[model samples]
Target: MFKKIVMFLYVMNLAFVGNAFAAGQDREDGLPGMPYRTPTDKEFRVCADPENLPYSNQKGEGFENKIAEVLAKDLGKELTYEFWLDRQGYLRNTINAQRCDVIIGMGSDVDTLRTSKPYYRSGYVFVYRKSSNYNIKDWNSEDLRKGIIGIVGESPPTIPLRDNDLMANARPYRLQRDLNLPPGHMIDDLVAGKIDVAIIWGPLGGYYAKKAKEPLVVVPLPEFKSERNSFDTLKGKAEFNISLAVRKKDKDRMEMIQGALDRNQSKILKILDDYGIPHVPVVLSDKIGN
Candidate 1:
């Protein structure tokens, strides 16, 4: 009887030891200490617009497409895209729905969306017909005093033009349109001496003016400068910035993304410069608001 009791206690001890060991192993496997675990087959989803240019398109030819490509390469994941027309439905129907993990081409200062620190910078610009005598290199200078300045209706640029006393005396009119002409016909008119100067996004103005065979020059507007362009995620994901969105529970994935972003910052900036991404003015956000 004594021998049997001893044997039973020994077997019980062995079973307890085995169970403890198994539990420890399970804990380690579940939450292993590592930078970031290997991603599953389908990890990052790049959300983009099908028709937006210089930003993204279905054909994967825009700057955002190129950025997504580089990020995917670094993450060792296959890239996928959620293509949707850019509109109010973009965030609710697409990004927030998890159709895609990230949204590129978002404004850094947008209150509704959370964004990363400034990645690139450019500014709204003044484009003029080459023959126009007005040279508006500086928005504060008296140069703008000499001619009519055309601007798109209800744009960020309108704020500055209104606040500055420079255009105070001059009447502001909508960029005129002609019924008999196709779209961008006003640009043609500008080339043929119909309008003197216009304010526009630097990239579009520069590209289109050149495309239109109009000898035009570009000048950055002073007040509306420094709009930082960044990728956006839903609000409150500040710790896991949308610079690279991952599953909220995936801390490893977020760290890997941060690592990739840090490693590729220089290359990213170089690509942006080479392509003239025309980002919003980045450094001057605090002083200027619209």
Candidate 2:
């Protein structure tokens, strides 16, 4: 599950064709331009999945898109995107390839890229119809086992489900899929009565629950310890701090991006609220697990 989450953060592929920039120009600060560095002084180039929403998309309807707009405006730069599919080779082909300068949303703990201070924190959530009146507050609730629970295959929430002996009641969905298709199908199934409940990422759960035809309940899973013998000693943190990311060596660009985030913090928080994105107070840390 940990590996899958990390891969999801690291391997989003974007498919875009834009004018390539010249590399190796000397900067006014007298530092040599890093290879494949975009002209950051004039543009806020972002690498994003063109179809992943609640996060980003080609239509600029996602919260990440909205946040990117705020940052770009605050920085006085034109916002441009390198649209890609969120799949294996994403970081390799886009940001790592120097096709863009930043990824609007990335887990702060991702070691492969230099990440900015987290803007917000979020986690997995339990989504059920408000009509069900289940009031599920944690993984141990007996109501969870009494109904069909939809979960992303190998997601962190599955650990608790297994620990509570609820696997038999679970319906696992694909963790990765074709980017051309819209997301939030699990919530769709829950709304249609195909599943009684869904344990999904907080952002997806909150966004889709709000858009569902009937009212839905979204409950965040708090941090806990894993009970599986193999992972007994490990702490299972459902929540993760989210931040912008740049190439590992691009400290200057990262500082600039951080400045933009700091300046427009309120606007970004408003965007999250408007989208119904479930989040908690930011914890400025790069460590993923203890």
Candidate 3:
């Protein structure tokens, strides 16, 4: 009888071991059978520009660069950067090609690109001289009848700009010193009085408005929607969210990347705020693109 009892116990132990192994296998082979493992001892890749300021650079001084650092720390991995000029083709050639795993500081609304939830949002604003009596209450206020507004060629402005019939009057001009230009430079011309007003991205608008040493007010554009910003991966890449991209495929490394982002979202935001990263949206509106 004692031997029989011992045999029963041994059988139970074997059963438990089999179940454990099955569960582990299931986790490793998630539904659709893609292996999802938490990565460790890996370097996660981020795409960045070598010279772009306020965004990213090799020195890792840009806002996105700092955010990457925080994310890497949270993931328990090292941060690796791939330098690409901030151009239309950068994402495809670098990020999509697996040269980098993520594109930080991307517009969250770009439907063609996949994005994580927005950590910050801001509206397009026109920066103008403080001395000007531009009572531009929002994007589509009637007060704009008094002045000419500058905008970048083929850039997105809030609804009022799109509907207000000002595109005909607002002239497109080149403002950035670099070939990879940002729309905010129109505001630079506005401060210099090259143009009366400039529709600009919130961060750059906020940054240069202060730097010009000119009196400027960042008036919120009504009907002007806040552009949600986030990091990007390839569209429909289901595992892209949690996986780390290496030049070669390594399942364990991917797990580490996912763990890092999950663990560090809050800390990343705080670091961004400390540097005046300018991501948090002060307002929320339900209006869709007009």
Candidate with the greatest TM-score versus the true structure: 2
RMSD of 2: 7.0
lDDT of 1: 0.49
Ranking the candidates on TM-score from highest down gives 2, 3, 1
What's the lDDT for residue 177 in model 2? 55
What is the C-alpha lDDT profile of model 3 across 1-290, one tens digit per residue?
11001111111221101121121122211234323234334866787777665666789977678878887777666888778665434444555555566655543333223444444555446677889877777545665756777764333352346456666667665322344554346666787688888775555566567656688887644433333312122111100011112222333443454466567777766765655434444222421111
TM-score of every prediction relative to native: 0.61, 0.84, 0.63
Better of 1 and 2 by TM-score: 2
C-alpha lDDT of all candidate models, in order: 0.49, 0.72, 0.49
Q: On residues 1-290, what C-alpha lDDT tens digit does candidate 1 reach at each position?
A: 11001111111221101121121122212232323224356677777767555556789876678888887898888888878655433444454554665554443333233334445555556777767666677557566666666664434455556556545533343332222443344355567766667665554454456567757776665543322323122111101111333323445554565666677877776666655534443454321111
- Model 1: how far is 51 from its true place, Å? 0.8
TM-score, cand. 2: 0.84
lDDT (Cα, tens digit) per residue for candidate 2, span 1-290: 12114522212211110101111121222223434554666898998877777778899999999998998888889999988675655665667667788888776766667778888888888899999989899876878877999987656666677877888999988666534455888898999899999988888889999898999999998776765546443445578777787877888888887888888888888999999999898765445311
Best by lDDT: 2
List residue ranges in candidate 1 displaced over 4 A: 1-40, 110-114, 141-148, 165-194, 206-212, 224-254, 279-290
True-vs-predicted CA distance for residue 100, candidate 2, Å: 0.6
